[model samples]
Target: MTNPDKTGLKPTCREAHRLVSEGMDRELSFVERTRLRLHLMVCDGCTRFNGQMALLRTAMRRFPDEHGK
Candidate 1:
C-alpha cells in the first residue's frame, strides 16, 4: 500500500478501518487513501465492512422522524 508519493509502507487492517471511517467524515490524504484502497483490495472482510458502513449511513440519513416531541 505504498502512497502515491511512495512515502511509507502499507497500513494494518485496524488502521485501514480507521481510514475508511475518516474518509466518510473528511477527505483523506493521498497516503491514507492509497493504503486503504490497497488494503481493501486484499481484505474482503474490510471491503464488505466498508460497504456495510455506507449502507447503514445511507439508511440513517434517509430515516424519517415522525414525532415532533
Candidate 2:
C-alpha cells in the first residue's frame, strides 16, 4: 500500500479537519489553504463540514458576549 501522506493524494482526515478550523479562523498558511481547497474539490464531506463551520461562526458572531465581563 502506498503511503498516502507521501503521495499527497490522501491527506489524513485529521489534517483536513485542522485545516478546516484554521481556514475558519483565517489563520491557515497559504500552502495549507491551497491543500485544503484541493481536498474540498474532491471531498463532499469536507465541503459540508466547512459549510457548517461557517454557520457556526455566523451564529457566534451574532450572539457574542457583549459586556466582556
Local accuracy of candidate 2 as per-residue lDDT tens digits, 1-69: 987674584456667878888777678877787778888888889889888998999998888596973
Model 1 lDDT per residue over 46-66, tens place: 999899989988997788767
Q: Best-fitting candidate, measured by TM-score?
A: 2
Q: Candidate 2's error at 8, in angstroms?
A: 1.7
lDDT at 22, model 2? 76
Task: Estimate every model's Cα lDDT from 0 to 1.
Answer: 0.80, 0.78
Give me the displacement of residue 66 in model 1, in angstroms. 7.4
| Clash-forming residue pairs, model 2 | none
